[model samples]
Target: MGNYEQFHLIVKWKEQALMIESLLFLFLNIILSDKKQPVSSTPKTYIYDT
Candidate 1:
């Protein structure tokens, strides 16, 4: 019973860690995509100006 309890605790910890990592990954992706979008649009504006 004690070993089973320990196993459950470890599993819970691992799940929490995975959740945090995925959230961080998603956050970074959103930030990077936003940064890229503006930079990408800048070229079109420059071409129109020229």
Candidate 2:
């Protein structure tokens, strides 16, 4: 019973960690996309011109 409880706790912690990591990754992606937006548009314009 004791070992089972510990395993459950570990699983819960692992889930929380994954959630936080995904959130952080999403945040970084948003920031990066925002930064790249202007540069990315230039390529699209070029593509349209061609």
Candidate 2, superposed: residue stretches over 4 Å from native: 37-50
Clash number for each model:
0, 0
Over 1-50, each residue of candidate 2 has an lDDT whose tens digit, in order, gives 99999999999998888778767766765787788754343432222211
C-alpha lDDT score of every prediction, in listed order: 0.66, 0.66
Candidate 1 lDDT tens digits, 1-50: 99999999999998888778767766765787788754343322222211
TM-score for every candidate vs. truth?
Answer: 0.68, 0.69
Q: Candidate 2's error at 41, in angstroms?
A: 15
Q: Which clashing pairs does model 2 show? A: none
Compare the candidates by TM-score and give the number of the best one.
2
